[model samples]
Structures are given as structure tokens and as C-alpha cells.
Target: MDARPSAWIIAAVVTFYMSAALVMVFVNKAVLNSTPDLPLLFLFIQLIIAVVLLHAGALLTPKIEVPPLDLHTAKKLTPVVLINIVGLVFNMLCLRDVEASFFQIARGLVLPLTISASSIATRSRPSISVSFAATIVTIGFFVGVAPEHTLPTASVPSGLSLFYGFLSSLFIAIHAVLIKSSLPFCSNSTIQLAYWTNAGSAFFLVPFILITGEPGNLLALVSDPKWHMSTLFWGSLITGVFGFLLCVAGLLSIKVTSPITHMFSSAMRSVIQTLLGVCIFHDVLTTNRLISLATILGGTMYYTWLKSNQPPAQSQRPQADQEALDNGDREPKVGWQAPDLDEGLNGKN
Candidate 1:
């Protein structure tokens, strides 16, 4: 694939990705609210669906190819997959307690956290503008989640929920760094990485779900006469399907365009999700929250712009591409760089 795709193609990929991702958030939220006790089970279902879709695509599509999940590769990716599971579980935990609007606001913390983590890991300092943008994002998250924004009728997000949200963001940030570091060991295909990660995660999550007694909750939920079987079945299926699509769409978008484009698209999705939360879920959107949202969006956009404008390190750029070629077929390398704030932001949900 060309490093720089045509403008229209990039736009189309980004649009498709954003649409799928935004829809998945709402679908997952609905399912979670309907069955609050089965967050881990819900996540496991999504992972299984993703694994099936990925394998199916690999088998059926002429162009799409997946790498084998060999023992060595699995060992390397174990940490990444584990961190991802933690992030996903905590994300659902946070979502179960907090409204979608608050969830988005709390998610704004991922960018700054990722930047900080990246800086520490790479031992390369970001520019002044980057630092400033990170600071703005941090402040925006705090302002957006302030207790003053809670309406009289609205239920405040419990302290535990807030803690989980922050912890989820931190885990995601750490995962991004690990992904960047582990790029050399895996095939350059993001599709391959996603497939194996989801597959491995499904395997890892089974024991946890069983141990946590979610199976009993699930059985109770299914047996309850008040619950409509058709509704639950279809809702869970749709959420799983959407989740699979969201993962593929995000990876595809990054493949076609640069990560900078993906980041901007994610920022757009965040804004839309926030607005939809207010309009659909009747989330309290105080003036402070609105200002904070603007700040978060503005900071992220500015950070992306700065990153794009700065030239890649001359020595590192070609070597990264060469490493991709050496690892596998001449497909575009998805591993050279991590998913950054965009993946961290959405991957949590």
C-alpha cells in the first residue's frame, strides 16, 4: 500500500471508521445498561465475534491475509493482550456506572497519558507545543468531570467509577507503548495483530468470567421471565458484530491514512458521541462541560497538527519500513507505530 493514499479514499475510510465506532459505543452502552451484571461476559462475546470475523475474512478474502498465532508470537503479545483485557474490562466497569457523556470526558485523559508514557519510554522529550497541548487536555478532563456539572436530577458517577475510568485510560496508555515496542516481533499487519489479540483475549477471559461467577449471572438473566430472549439475543449479536467492525475499520483507516488522520477522526467521534449522549440519553451538559469538551478537542487537534508538521526522524523512518518488509509480505506496516490516542480512546470502550 502507498504510504500516502488519495484524499478521497482517506476520507471515505475515515468516515466509515467513525460511523462504525460511534455506533458500537452506543450499542455496547445499551447492552451494558440492560444487563449491568455481565460486563465481562459482554466483552468476551465481542472478542469471540471479532475472532470469528477476522478468521472468516482471512479465509474468504483474496487480498486480506492473517499471520499465524505461533507460540513465539503469542508469548510476545501476551503482555499487550493482557493490558488490553484490563483496559476493556475496566472500561465497561466505568461505563456501567457513569453516563456516556461523562465517559467521553474522562476518555480525554488518554491523549495526555499516552504522550507522557511515550516520552518516558522513548526518553525523547516532546516539543513545547506538544507539552502545552497535553496540559490543556489534562485540564479539560478535570473541568469536564467536575461535580458542579452534575444536574440536580442526575446521578453522580460514583468514586469507584471515576477511579476505574482513570485506571482504564492508564492501562490503555501503557498498552500503546507496549505495542510500539513490540512491533518488531509481530507481522506488520494490524489485522493480524487485532485477530490474534482478540483470539488470545477470548482464551484468557474465559477463566476470569467463570471465576467471577458471571456465568451464573448470565444464566439468571436468561431465565428471568421479565427479560425478552429475542431482544437480548439480537442486541448482544449486534453489539458483537459492531465491535468487530469497529476494530477492523480502525485498523483499515490507519493502514490507508496516517495515524494523524485517525487521531482527528477519533476526536470528531468523541465530539459526536458527547453530543449524542446529551441529545439521546439526556446527559447533563452544563456550560462547563461544553467548554471542557471544546478544550479537549482543541488540544488534541493541535497536538495532531504539531505531530504531523514535525518531520519524522530521517534515520528511523526508512529503517521502520525496512523492518516491516523483513518481517512479512510487503504490506503496509501497522506495527511501526502504535494506535496512539485514537486507539487508546476507543479501544477502552
Candidate 2:
């Protein structure tokens, strides 16, 4: 099979990924608003749904093979799954407390945080332009979300909400770097990694849901007759379906393109979501907020352009056999190579 996809394929996958991501955010926000107390439970349900869909896809399509899960892979993927759960939980918490428009501003921090994590993890330094762009993005996020900058009539996010949003960005940044480092163990298949991690997340989230006392809240919600026809119920179902679609599309996008591309798509998705939030939810859009959003988007676009203009870096490591022949350093016979730091995020290569 040709592992490298065509440009059309990349375009299609990115479009699908961005569209699904945009819709999923709104769905999650709606569901979280309708049932503010069960954010973790809602995420747990989404994970379950994603697991089911992934398994079904593998079973139905012979071409899409799911690697067997063994002890070694499980141990390697545990941290990734745990981090995913934490990031997701924080994301929901932020969504529950912050407006949809401001939510993207919070998430805008992920790019800089991811870059910082990557630099620390792999000893890789981004170009000066990339660093400068990251700084601009950081400033933009602050301008967009700071409470003091808002008009007196405008509602601002609470300190707690901003804290949750920051945590969400930090956790997701860490998750991205960890997933990148763990990709070699997963045979470099984003689909396979996504499936196993999602399954593991579902497994781990079970105990968390129970410990958080969400099962009782879930039962109460389900048992209430008035809840059946409410937005909560319908929104949950919609988000569940969209959640699976988003994961699949996200994996495909990362598979076909670089993580930088994925980040750019995410930035664009944030732009669309912010517009939708303003229109659909009547979110308070202050002058500073708009300018901040523009700054973030502009920085992201400039970063993307800079990345595109740069030549691909040469590989620093030789083949294992070659290395052994040259340096007489015998390494383990693990047929894995560290993926390019610039290529994909969150094990997407």
C-alpha cells in the first residue's frame, strides 16, 4: 500500500477534520450547558462510543487492520490514555464555565505549549519565526480572554474558568508531545494508536466516573421523564456521533499531513467556532476579543507560511545496521525509528 497520500486526499481529510471538529465543539458546549454537572460522564460516554465505532470499522473493513493489544503496548500507551482523559476532562470543564468564543482563545495556548514540550522532550528547537509566532499567539490569547479588558457591559470568564482552560491547554500540550514520543511502539499507525488509546481511556475513565459520583447523576438524569426530550439528551447523542467522526477525521488529517497542518486547521476551526458562537449563542464579542482573535489567526497563518517555505530537515540518525557498522554500538532489534518532530502531533504518524 502507498503510505503517502495525494494532495487531494490531504485536502479532503483536512476539510473533514476541521468541519467535524468545529461541529463537535458546538455540540459539546450545548450538551455541557444542558447538563452542567456531568462533564466527565459525558466524556466517558463519548469515549465508549468512539471505541465501539473504531472496533466496528476495523471489523467491517478488512483493509483497516487493528493491531492486537498486548501487555507491552498497553504499558506504553497507559500514560497517553491517562493524559488524554485529563485533557478531555479539563476541556469539558472549560466549556461548561466559559463561553464558546472564549473557549478557542483558551485553546490557542496549545500551540506554544506543544512547541515548548517538544523542545524539552526531543531537544529540538523551532525556527526563530516559529518562536516569534508562538509569542504573538500567546499575547493574543491573553488579550482575548483577560477579564479586565472586557467592556463593563460584557460578561467575562471567571478566574476559575480561565484556570480550567489553561489546564486544559497544558494537559493537551503534554499529551501531544507524549503521544509523539510513543508512536514508534504503535507501528507509526495513527488509526491504530487512536483506537487503542481511546479504548484504554474508556477503561480508565470507568473508575474515574464512579469515583467522581457521576454514575448517580447519570442515573438521575436518565430516570427523569422531562430529560428525555430535552436538548441534553439530543445534544449528547449528536456529540457522541460527532465525537467519533472527529477522531477519525483527525487521525486521517494527521496521517496525510503534518501536525503543523493539523494545528493550522485547528486554528481555522477556532475561527469558525468563534463566529458561530457569536451568532448562535450571542456571545459577547468585545473589540479586544476580536483583535486578539485576529492576532492569533494571523500568527498561525504566518507560522504555517514560514514552515512551508523552509526545507525539510535531514534525518540525524542512520539505519540501525549502518549505525552499528559505523560506531560498533549494538542496539536493540526494535524496528522502530523516532518520527520527525515536525511531522505529526500526538502520535499521528
Candidate 3:
């Protein structure tokens, strides 16, 4: 077995896991329709993936040459780093409330809004065209929102969830942009930030788990198994592998057509899941659903196109410079970078 194939297989696995998670969670009806752990979930999944990717990375290290960690050079970055942690918590909270499918929809909505918000909030002038494109996506999102997939008009996470979810996405986007912005200054900030955020989030969640997560039930949740494998087994697998895979894969894989990408796929997952539910599981799809589906696909196509074309975004340039300057690069460099475990998380928006 040549090591190269295994390396490619790992990269491919991310995409597979992400797409497969939709099927797994949907089939088991474990979609975070209400209450999912975003940060802990991210921590759980990323920990496993980091292990796999890092291990695989070592084998490929001779080939790829990942950079070494730099010391935390500047003190000014502390505030943004703190904000990143808070953002992660809110994102997790939002994820816990919504289904994976709808959560994905919320994910799609956040990409555009984050850029626009950063421009105004930070006093940075992002591209008007990108902002306009994002506006279209937002409008399309609301157009796509249907009563069926939406929360009970007055539900906690439904309307509120969407708001928080969108906000969470913004935070994440801001974090991404912020990370990329700050990357230039230190050269290690992106990876350092990732490590810190993971540890920081764990620090944050530890108290929550102790205070709120019942040790007995959690143990039971892990040890207990049923229906061929226990809920604990499946949940762990879902939480640990499937969730991480979906997210990491989405992040790592090639920038192909959005139809295949999770942005659209997440939304697509809902349609297929709903269709399967109605046809196989005998779920219902109203006329409104039919139209929403079309609208979502259309809007997603537009957003996806924007995302795809967004590489040339004139707006993110200054932010990217700020990022590279902060992360580890002593020299000036900006734009997108790859996604991976030890290094590769930070990239252009």
C-alpha cells in the first residue's frame, strides 16, 4: 500500500463523512432538530479528525512540510481571540437547537451576512458587489424559509434559533476573516488560534458539562448500546466521526460546484431527507415546500456562485493581509490556503 493513496483517501474521507453524516443523522432521525452541541460537538469531531489527519499528515510530512508553531508574539490579539471563543460557544448553542439540515441552511445564510457585518461593524469597506450578492442571498434565504422547515412560528430556536444561528455564522465568518486577517502578523496565529480555541472552548465547556451535563447519563449515553449498536454508540459515532467529517470534509475538499458542496448539499440534504421522510417515512411536503425548494436551490446556486467567485473578493484582501501579518508570516502574503489538522485551517474568505 503506497502511502500516497492513503493520504488522498484521508482527504477524500472528509467529503465522504460530511455527505454521509446527512444520511446517518437523517436516517436515525438524530438531526439536531432541537438541541445539538455545536462547540462540544466541534471539539469532539475535530479531536478525532486532528488525530487522523495529524497521523496521516506525519506520513505525508516528508512530502508536505507543515510549519512549526510560533510563540504568541503580540498581546494585542488577545481580544479578537477571546471573541472567537465566545463566537464558537454561540455557534454551538445554535447548532444544538436546529436540525442538521436546517442548521446547514442557517450556515449558508451566515456566509454572506458575516462579510457585510464585518465591513460595517469593523469600519472596513468590503466590496459593494459582494455585499449586494450577500443581500441577495439573505433575501433568498427568507424566501426559502417555509413554515414546514421553520420552527413553530414562536418556538425558541426556530425564529430565535435562525437569528442566533445566523449570528453564530457571522461570528464564525468574522473569526475566519479575523484569523486570516491576523495570520500575517505572527504566521502562527491561525494554527495557534485553532489550538487555543479548541483548548479554550474545552475550558469553557468543561464547566458547562460539569454543571449541566449529567455524569451518570453521559456515561450511560456512552456505554449504553441498543438497536444493533446503542444510542451511545451511534451518537458518539455521529458526534465524533460523522459530524467532524461533514464539517472538515466541507472545509478540506476541492472547490467544485456548489451543488456538490455542503453549502448546497446541506440544504440539499434537507430536501432529500424530507423527500425520503415523506415518501419512505411518509412525511409531507406542501405546495409551499415545493416552491421553497426551488427558491432555496436557486438562492443557494446564487450564493454558491458568489462563494465560488468570492475568491476574487476585493473586500477580503485587506483583512487577509491583516491575518497573514498576525499568524506567522513575517513577509507579506494573503489569499486562500488549504484546510488541515496541524495547519491549513486559516484561508482567504
Query: Which prediction has more favorable lDDT, 1 or 2?
Result: 1
Which lDDT tens digits does candidate 1 get at residues 1-349? 2355666887787887888777767777777778888888888887787777777887899556667768988888888777777777787788778888787644666666665665555444545565676677767778777777346645577889888888877776666556544545555666777776678778888998999999999899888988766755666678667777666666666567533335445656777888898887888888778887888788877765764564543335675443322121112233343332124223454
| Model 2 agreement with the true structure over 294-317: per-residue lDDT tens digits | 987888777667645543322344
Q: Estimate the TM-score of every prediction.
A: 0.83, 0.83, 0.57
How much lDDT does each candidate structure score?
A: 0.66, 0.65, 0.42
Model 2 misplaced regions, further than 4 Å: 1-7, 148-154, 223-226, 229-232, 312-349
Runs of candidate 1 with Cα error greater than 4 angstroms are: 1-13, 252-265, 304-347
List the lowest-lDDT window of 10 residues for candidate 3: 340-349
Poorly placed runs, candidate 3 (over 4 Å): 1-96, 121-132, 146-160, 182-200, 219-229, 242-284, 302-349
> In candidate 3, what are the lDDT values of residues 1-349, reduced to their tens digit?
1122243564365346345545444433443332232234434443444334434544665632233434453343454444555554555555456543344444556545444434444444544444454454455455445555443443223667677666666555554334444445434433333434433334444555556554543455455453222443455455444433333443333222211222334444445544554555333445554665666566556654644443333334685554432122111124422121100121011
Clashing pairs in 1: none
Q: How far is 236's C-alpha from truth in model 1 (Å)? A: 2.3
Error of 1 at 343 (Å): 3.8
